[model samples]
Target: MDGWKVGVLHSQTGCLALAERGPLNGTLMAIEEINAAGGVAGRLIEPVVLDTESDENKSAELVHKLIKEESINVVFGGYTSASRKAMLPVIEKSDSLLFYPIFYEGFELSDNVFYTGACPNQYSVPLSEYLFENYGNRFYLIGSNYVFPRESNRILRDLAVQNGGTIIAEKYVPLEATKDVFKPIIQDIAKLKPDVVISTIVGDGIMDLYSAFQDAGISSDEIPIASMVTSEVEIEKMGHAAAAGHIVAASYFDTIDSPENAKFVSNYKSKFGQNMRTNMCVESAYCQVHLFAHALNITQSIDTKALRAAVLGAQFNAPQGRIRMDVENHHTHLWSRIGQIEKNGNIQIVAETKGAIEPDPYMIHHAAERWQPSLISGVAK
Candidate 1:
């Protein structure tokens, strides 16, 4: 087996770095562990990392450089949908592969990329259904001005409308906006008095938004803010009070009770530091690497065409559950779980699906169907 060089592109310094850093750390940890375990195909994996500075244009430029100049074959990284879309053309043009590790708005499929994150069906649908069931029908929507939030809100709005619910208000803010900017939005939310607030805000903007909510004397108990993007890491950074009681729908949490998760959390903390936290993106990043290793073992080459065949339908006992790549859509099946942030900066998994939920990136067809997946048998192991 010949040595395989891969590219790792992520935002190390910018608005999105708060979230992107976790995936970067997770990917590096996986590479280190794989190298320790006799390497992939007996050939040490070489990673060429490039910081995109959280800029979409920069991401595309760097990806082109990685392929044409760096001569890397397979690559992994990209936290935001904009960043991923920026690199998609480059990846496709270069005939390379990208293993994207963050959950995003679907309605997209590329032969040049493999998505290891949750799709619309895996996160948004379940979350909306849960809110509709547990909360009331009236909802307020807010998010960063971006493709992911806008698209996600579109899916959620369709689901809410189909289920006889109403979207009281919809709003958006710039990606780099601060908390002071959200004060008016918080006031509007208070006046609307919606039963739930669906927030799609990402990156550092989250800190300000959550803080603004708190300052407005709004608590999750009053009008709980539910999100598909918020994670344990965000909660930790926002402080316990700012995020407590907020509901988040995701496929993985740090508090998942399982031997595999325990080992994963332990190893991550040991490698990154005790102060560092793990979230859905981090777990997906780590799991995707192992899955890629399995694919590499089968294909024994770095060619994107061969690797795609090898990756299709590959399964790994991930920290979340048993996740398998979808042969038809190039996505991964994942377990859906709704978590509430506790005061200790940990998410308490209040509800979860029984088994792996199939990927459905294109939500255009799923709007009329029920969003709930099969219920969990009992406590998640």
Candidate 2:
């Protein structure tokens, strides 16, 4: 078959498989849709998928292989911040393009990568504001002991202090920590009686965190756990009872109302499974492919420079809405939303931006009169 070969580098197995598979599936679904619609520039997008097995070294290695060995130009993958960091040097060294489809702890940017997920300003600031307004002034920050968690918590801590709120306590546990590791933290939360728990925990370890919280008999309504991390993908693994009533700040949810979203969700479920779910990351992956196709059709070349030029100012009618790539930064403009995780792995959105919010990756531009801080410490929000 005459086609363009793109590399797929997300995990399909191992620890993060539950959440990571959704992104890979979404990428494939979009490629299939584009192919069925006569392909990009009349040639199918043939993806060469490589599973990283949730390993940082593996991520870097696979990206290198895709670029160096396979001679692929465009790739889509990387979930954890660690994986992105691990894969960066290789992505830049070869001048290949990587479409990262996850919300991250901002502060760093690359000429070789395009960020499709929400920027820190899009997810973090609005989420912090919502929590402080609806929940309470006292906050407990917790997350996995990794780049994303540490950086995410740094923003939350500052926001807590900036918003007339106080950080009661902050903590981090291992990525592979079990429920036992969170028992003590739960004890501290119970004792301190913070109004809300702002968790940035990621991967399978977060299930342990939520399970520990549930085992403690602590209800979310009384003091909810808010995060940009938890999504329908994780909730599906942890079960509705384990994940219900929690808060999630994101760019996309299956419950979003729009013809584009309705079709995206229906197509995704039809391609994957009826029991499957969608989230911010999955939607970003799906959008990235369509955007890549759009840019490819315009530029008609996989040359990184030409493709980058085409993508930098491109726009696509995405599942989240009509999103546009930032002309200055490579990140995409996206809708911001805060939703509560409901039963059956659904997210009930509580707060949302009126329209697509532009990219402010450094978190320096979208300042409120209340927030004069300039993110000088490399914090995400």
Candidate 3:
């Protein structure tokens, strides 16, 4: 059988490296497993890796080159919304398949992309409901200045007001800005003292924010932090002491107690290292490969159009649990898990939505709904 080539576009340097490495490693592991099991369609899968260097323009350039020159069958890997958005035009024009494996703010759907990450239903809605049900009516919002955080916090703001919760403060720092160095904003957080803090900060900025929150003597136990972007991998880099006791909501965690997860953990540790941390992105990337392989096998070909159709409605029982793609929005159905960070840099799952939640990219029920139709229609166009 002929070898099928796929491209891995990820940042090995710059801000997103910490998040990208785990997933990239997971993808490699998946490739190894597939090859061991006689490869996809009796063809060895070859991943052509390219470092985006966390530069949006560089990522776009490389993606364009990969699609046109390398003739990669599918492209995978993107950690941030900016990187994904940067590659959109290139992939669309080339009519290439891209398996994006990170969660971001909803309101995007495309025929050229297969999103295996959480959308509003898999992350934001469940998180908002969890906060409202447990903590009373005051909330604070914080994030890095970017499309994902800005859009996601908008939804949070709307949800807070809709559910009778007050947003005491909303703050954002540039991607390269450090939260610890910003004294005035730290002072403001102390002043508002909201009941809950919802953080969407990403990259190295997260360490600064959490450290500053700690230095300001704000206890997570008091004004508990419920973050959409924090994970075990980030905590490992920041140290468990900085991230300990914080609550994080996502579709997957490393500590889920299931045989599938247990084997996944064992295999991952064996392949990577005992100290390696697994997060939602890693699991999603790993699952994406297997899911793609499943679809390819079912269709019995690697034809782009056929594969896209197969992926749109594909369902699989992944290590994280059952996942299905929602045809309308091109997002995924995934179970939401809320985990508390432990001192050992591990997240312990405290609560989980019973089953996979359907993706709602347009967010039809929120005040944001007014803008959804227009945005989705434009995307469709």
Q: Which candidate is the best by lDDT?
A: 1
Candidates 2 and 3 compared by TM-score, better number:
2
lDDT of 1 at 314: 96
lDDT winner between candidates 1 and 3? 1
List model 3 lDDT by residue over 218-306, tens digit each.
88788778898988877887777878888889988988878988988899999889998788898999989888888888887878899
**Lowest summed lDDT over 10 consecutive residues: which window, candidate 1?**
372-381
TM-scores for all candidates? 0.96, 0.94, 0.93
lDDT of 1 by residue, 1-381 (tens): 556788999888977777888999989988888888988879977889889997999999998998899888788998878888899999988889999999988889999889999998888887887887789999999999988899888888888888899999999999889878898899999998999999998878888888899989998899999998888888888899999989998999999999989989999999889988889999999888888999998988877888899999999999998999999899999999998888877888988888888898885555445443345322453
Q: Which sections of candidate 1 miss by over 4 Å?
A: 364-381
Show model 2 residue runs off by greater than 4 Å.
370-381
RMSD values, in order shown: 1.8, 4.2, 5.8
- Which is better, 1 or 3, measured by TM-score? 1
Ranking by lDDT: 1, 2, 3
Local distance difference test, each candidate: 0.87, 0.85, 0.81
Show pairs that collide, candidate 2: none
